[model samples]
Target: MAVHSPTSGPCRSIVVSKLVAPATRRSLENMSRRSGVDLFFSSTLSSAELTDRAAVAVVVPVPHAEDEVMEMVHRIRELAPTILLCGVIDVPDQSLWLFAERNGFNLVSSAGGIGAALSRRLAADDLGVREPIAVLNSSDIAGRLGLLGEFEVEGCSVALWRGGGRLGCLENRCTHSGAKLSEGEVEDGVVTCPRHGSRFDIVSGERVRGPADSDVKHFDVFEREGRVWIVPEP
Candidate 1:
């Protein structure tokens, strides 16, 4: 039982099980129409039923049957290791989501929440999600006064400063007026926003001066393998 929807633009191949509630199936069909993704509905997880071109498969397990769900997941993993697996539950259960994640499901969501979750996943992929990025070499930073540099990672403009052998990374945009902090001046470990003179402690990401009441967003950074690495904010 495969149901096709009207699609547009670049489409992603998706296989969904018909065992889900009718409302869930309708929601997925509507989501496919709006998102321009292809959908294939099946009654089971059998290899003969699933299309080889499918990139993702949404499985709906029977309610309150944890063991049966795990068995199906195992069977699917063994049959199609390349396809990303997602589990949809009729009821919202936190423990079930955790179990699915631990048992190899890439995503787990409530039946009604599946559309929104899948849409977010697609949008994240479109934006080219960012992870940890190397900013500079540890040798490039000097002791005491430290070093200051600007970088663009994962579509975010950021400023990196090192002081007293400690490194700090913050978004370049000022909290007050969207000014570029990289254009500001740094003194005694505090960076003054060039536009409104708002001051912030780079090391602590704390706003020490007025006009910018909020603290700048801080990013995790560490020195590893003689290089400074920045873990982009999720």
Candidate 2:
């Protein structure tokens, strides 16, 4: 896997090989142990195409030729491997978050290298996880001063309320189709999705509004070092 920094323009580009070319495939198979390239293999058609796009991205190292990885992904999508590994090699210079969101591909690299340090960190949930740092410190303080009870819940995303000097953490996931409640907007104590118009209580994790039949998860909230923490159940 190749790790890349978030860039302002499209990620680095590479020359994409023709998927049906036989010599290209043979050449790829022959190339071994390169010092400065990202390596990716897949066995699905869709993933292969996606990989192709990733290959020519000169913005980052093209470890695996785009065509080859795509072919691999097309071949293996049905096996459902025991593990799926992704690497975000380097911290993106810009909105790595937005890029992942737009492409629906999670980042896997934190370093820009091709060594063992580039191995995927799939088991650690927080390895590359980045969230919005609360900007309204005063609001958080107010919320904490009021203190809501702690609880565990699950949803598409996490939710918090700006009240009483601290926060009341709520499960931001919607059960219906597992839509992110955080992506929804809050109004009158309800967080409603712009996607399907699903709604829930921002404080209770209850499905007050729906296209969804299930409630979201809630978590215990706390504050330390001027930051809000939600201890979600493992």
Candidate 3:
């Protein structure tokens, strides 16, 4: 949020879990000074620290691999579900926000976009936001099982794919231009964007072709008793 008088501030607490970039670190530190929030930096977070300090949000940078970031999110959720989780990426990829949200993160913004997200979150934060697990049936979809399929999960567009003897679900928007991935072609476990020829792997959510800014999000698909279940987390 913006700067406020100390006496009339919400006095929020946000922790920087792993910020190594100089520019982003400076930007956030300056904002924290002006906003009157208890923003601080720490590499490690114990259960006691989270509970004793009353941290409202945790800022984690996605480095090395996205899987490591996901692990941290799960750990934070287990320690305290009410604390908001924010994931920071290297580039500006607004398209991955849904993917981040679906996987237990409250907000996922690029290095440049984190400020806006933090401002909005601190201004109007929620401690108990959650979505129930969603379910779909194999017989309900009106297409071949191996073809690309679209559905809704936690109010976000999701695409289901069954190919190469493998089954999985993924976010339906391209990270490059926000194009509908369902309109594209899925072959050999890769989804190609119809507009710009960008390709992404449905299984790992990695960008396989360019003109694509970043990779999409993936969800695990479990099939049993003629029904398909898609979990929000991958």
Q: For candidate 3, lDDT tens digit of each residue in 1-234?
A: 333222234454677765546655666676676666666566676665454334666787754445665577668755655556777776655545544554457677766667666876776644323322446676775355555468888778988886544565778888988898888887877778899999887766778899987889876555545666665641
1 versus 2: better TM-score goes to? 1
Q: For each candidate in the order shown, give its overall lDDT on alpha carbons.
A: 0.67, 0.39, 0.65
**CA shift of 213, model 1, Å:** 25
Clashes of 2: 51
| lDDT (tens digit, per residue) of candidate 2 on 27-146 | 323321332333333333233333333332211221233344333332322221111223232334444433321221222233333123322222243222222233234443552422
User: Candidate 1 lDDT, tens digit per residue, 1-234?
Assistant: 234531322334567777778767776777777886677766665675442543445455534566776677657745564355667777767776665654446567777777777767756655232345777876877463533688987888889876533566788889998998888878776788989999887755679897999989766565656777776754
- The per-candidate count of clashes, in order, stands at 0, 51, 0
Cα deviation of 207 in candidate 1 (Å)? 30
Residue 63 lDDT in candidate 3: 44
Best by lDDT, which number? Answer: 1
Q: Estimate each model's TM-score.
A: 0.47, 0.31, 0.47
lDDT, candidate 3, at 40: 52
Worst 10-residue lDDT window, candidate 3: 1-10
RMSD of each: 11.6, 17.4, 8.9
